[model samples]
Target: MKTYFPYQLKYVGVLFVFIAIVLSCIGNVDEFMRGLLAGRNDFETSILNEEATKVDQTLAYQPYFSEKEKDNYLKISLILSLSGFILYLFSKEKSEDEFYQQLRAKCLTQALLVTWLFTGLIYWIRPTYQLNGFYILQLHLIFFTIIYVYNKKWKFGTE
Candidate 1:
C-alpha cells in the first residue's frame, strides 16, 4: 500500500538509460574485437602471399593487444551485461533499500572502471585509424558521479 516517490521513478529511468548506453557501447566493442581477430588473420595471410579473407576495414584492429588483453575486454563485457540486468530488476521504488542502492553503486563503479580500462587500452594500442572515441568513458563517468552523489546522503554511501 506504500506509494513510491516520483523522483524514485526518475532515478530508475536515468539508471536504465545509463545501463542501455553502456550495454550498446559494450556490444559495439565486442563486434570490434571480432573484427580485430579477423583482421589479424588477414594481415598474416597477406604477408604469406595467401588469399586474405574480406575484412571490414571500418572494423579496425587494436594493435598491441595480446590474448590476455582480449580476454580482459570480454570479461568487462560479461560483468557489465550481468550487473546491468540485475540492477534493472531491483531498481524499483517499492524495492528501494540499502541493498538496491549498494547494487547501483557497485554496478556504476564497475561500468566506470571498465570504461576507463577500455579507453586506456585503446590509447595504448594506438590503432591505425586513431580510434580515440572517449564518448563512452565520459558517459559512464557522468552517470557514476551523479549516482554516487545522489546516494551519498542515503543509507548506502559508496557501497
Candidate 2:
C-alpha cells in the first residue's frame, strides 16, 4: 500500500478549510458589525438602520437565521472541515520516510483513542443534551486537532 498521499491533497484540504471558515463567519461577522455600530454615534444610527434594513431585504429572510438554516450551515461546515482534516492528515509529508510513516500511524491511533474517550464521556454524561449534531462535529474537530498536534510534534521532535 502507498504510505503517502499526494502533496496536492494538502492544498485541497486547505482550500476546503478556508471555504468552511468563510461560510461559518458570514453570519457572525454580519452580526458583530451590526452590534459594534448599532449604538455608536446618533448620526450614524439612521444610516445604519436604513442600510441594515435594505441589506436585510436584499438577503434571504433569515435575519438571525432560522433553525433549519443554521443546521444547514453547520452541516456544510462540518463536512468541509472533516474533509479538509482527513486530506491534511493523509497527505504526503515533505520527507516521506519510515519514521514519518510510523508517526502517522501513531497519531491516527492516538487521535482515534482520544476521540472515542471524549465521545463516550459526552454520551454518558449528557446523553440527551449532548446528542446535538454540533457535539459530534466538535468531536471530529478535536480528533483532527489531536492528529495534527501529534504529527507536528513528532515531525519536528522537541526542538
State each candidate's clash count: 0, 0
Q: Listing every candidate in turn, what is its Cα RMSD in Å to the true structure after a full C-alpha superposition? A: 12.0, 6.8
> Candidate 1 — worst ten consecutive residues by lDDT sum?
1-10
TM-score of 1: 0.31
Q: TM-scores of all models? A: 0.31, 0.61
Q: Lowest-scoring 10 consecutive residues by lDDT in candidate 2?
A: 54-63
Reference-based lDDT, each prediction: 0.54, 0.67
Taking the tens digit of each residue's C-alpha lDDT, what string does model 1 give over 29-95?
7567777677776676677543344333443565545556655655565455444433433335454
Clashing pairs in 2: none
Candidate 2's C-alpha runs over 4 A off are 1-4, 27-62, 132-138, 154-159
Q: 1-159 in candidate 2: lDDT tens per residue?
A: 244569789899888878877777763554665565544434454567757655444443325765577667867977787788767777877777777677767666777688778888977898875455655655666576677665677656722
